[model samples]
Target: MKKMLVLMLTLTMVLAISACGGKAKESTTESTQQPTTKTEEAAATEEEFLPEPGAKLVVWSSGTEKVLVDEAAKAFKEKYGIDVEFQEVGPDKSIERMTTDGPAGVGADVFLAVHDRIGSAVQSGIILPNDYHEEETKANNSDKAIEALTIDNILYGYPNSVETTAVFYNKDLVPEAPKTWDDVIKFAKTFNDPKKQKYAYMWENGNGYWNFGFLGGYGAYVFGKDGSDPSDIGLNNEGGVEAMKFYQSLKNTVLPLKTADITSDIKKSLFTEGKLAMNVSGPWDTISLKEAVKNLGVMEYPTLPNGQPMKPFSGVKAFLVNANTKYPNAAKLFANLITSEEFQIKDFELLGNLPSNKKAAENDKIKNDPFASVFLKQFENSVPMPKIQQMNAFWSVHEATFTSIWNDGVDPKVALDDMVKKMQDSIASSK
Candidate 1:
């Protein structure tokens, strides 16, 4: 009986050992297989994930257009989860700040200002090219703006607002609008009461801005037909001289105003009081004139004395992204949204400025607006202001040179010769 009990015990011990072995093997297998499943899950998670939120962007805008810029930025933040820190700086300070602070990472991630500053901004190596504007987006953009931003086929910014010249007249003084420049001249002559008040037409006699539209209408241009080529300055050309002569003819017919003499306040005071028949100014002048005069009328620039339509130099205001921005994608997203139609029209309504987006201009809200449509149509006949750095130097000297010629009896040819020489010299010196 003792031997039989011993054999049963041995068999039970062996079965227990086998069961323990099988359980150990299963434990080992699970440890190895669990990690594989986790690895697959981690890869899938990465693939399915969306970009992280809570990105922030810093921006700066030229002052006084705050109403327009602010609303647009607000819309951008709402559409995309972003925080925009915006500052309003003077128009002249925008480039200075960017050039000094952008590369250091202390400046704006995006900059909203004029396109004329692009040449200097690009050369500074801080403002980046917007190489990805979709074909549809390009289709609706201002061609002049596109040209301004494009440097050797690379575009630097998308245009938002276009500043162009239009005729603003006192409805009380000129019951009928003039259709041609000759009519305007005739009208000015008839209305000449300079002894009592300033005569008919007035514009800042400083920058070539006052000349661009008139000269353009007469088949003359600052830089010939191809605007980018500076070598073909039409200053001495026959068409150009004729345009200058026409301007000179107006010398005795109207009250002369220099850039320094005619401040914004002074211009508005004269025009609103029905002291002047017509004046050339930009969209920025609209609000003040509307406030100053109860009845203000705006129209396309009248035809040139040569009977050609007046084509003004279009000025585009755009936002440029900082190449050094840590959040480039976010900055680009904000830029794209601001230029979108929905946001643009809202900007127009709230700010009383024209929108560059074609679809936005066509919206019922914008199309039906009597004031908006009138200025918007002027885009059809505008060209972008020069994007060269020399343009700044040119603007600085313009008032002195033009005033001397227009009012002080300085020879127009001599003034133009000196002007062209200085402009070319300025461009060379900048390089």
Candidate 2:
């Protein structure tokens, strides 16, 4: 899936003191001693910790946030006289590391990732609730952003980035961005020139994300339970069906050049080359879009015939701690430092990511940036991506089934039935 909602949990992954207690003591002692050579000590301290005496922390991140995480760690050490160690790892591996590899040794005291992983992370019983928000923090950020990262009424991560699916169009081809999905379809059917080298939109691989957005426009929801309850499935409901039908109707009209290959770069290239007039994308590609095309325009995915703007699932990336970390207090401080307005705002400006910190949004640096703010607005009505583990099972069969209906001449009813059955089977197998 192009934009499968990534869920990150606060790992607070402390190794069992018994398991690595010996190594930790040695590492701590070494971390405190000044090396004989100043340059060597400086470089080593730069990578390891520069604690005042013996303060130490470990962090795991996606590596994209390396600079930000590192700077924050450095600041924490300077301010509180603590030493911090950091590692780079993707969200999936982070989860595996926490659950299967953490307690033994070599695990992070805190983890940084997205919100969608909360269910599985919590189910794994290795994450702890966060208690860092001030009243001002909640007031500045969207309530939904806060709620999305929260599980079991306990917030486990400090939401760091805001993401949503919005319409990105070329101003050269279209006079103005359409206000609704119906308008989008109408525009595609009316203006697209297949024989001439233009398309109204591009179909990546499947319509899950697009359909998910449309379902919201029609007042529909998937998984029914806001990730807190993982057993429920909402894909078979009326809204889901309607959303699917809408996507099926667009098969030939305005899809991308490579309908079967849902790769993002390919889709962006088509749009940039003037083959695609519009597509749904997030802040991840804002910079590339601007560099690829001139006069790029953005608009909310308009409502279905029902008058609701497509409330796409917003992605929430956050910093989490490992529950098993030996340095729980230090880990909490580190998580707090990462989410602080200074580091988060700087990251938002540098990366074009919508800031998760409430105060970061108001920073003068990003207040007027069009690309950043558009994504920020999408968060207003955005729903959190469902964080169920069964979601993986559903996705495995989703593309094939969706392709069958939209491209391979399969009946919608039959296709949906197979999808439901396959998903149910996956759920059973997982249990």
Predicted model with the maximum TM-score: 1
lDDT per residue (tens digit) for residues 67-157 in model 2 = 7777887788778877777788866468767887566656787887667777778888777677644343465566766777666677777
Model 2: lDDT equals 0.71
Model 1 — which ten-residue stretch has the worst lDDT?
A: 43-52
Residue-wise C-alpha lDDT for candidate 1, range 114-221, written one tens digit per residue = 877887888788787775544435777756667777777888886676667788888888878888767777887778785677668777655577767766776666
TM-score of each: 0.80, 0.78
- For model 1, name the residue pairs that clash: 314-383
Name model 2 segments beyond 4 Å from true: 1-55, 81-86, 132-141, 189-197, 203-207, 225-232, 256-259, 388-390
C-alpha lDDT of residue 291 in model 2: 82
Candidates in order have lDDT scores of 0.72, 0.71
All predictions: root-mean-square deviation over Cα? 11.3, 17.6
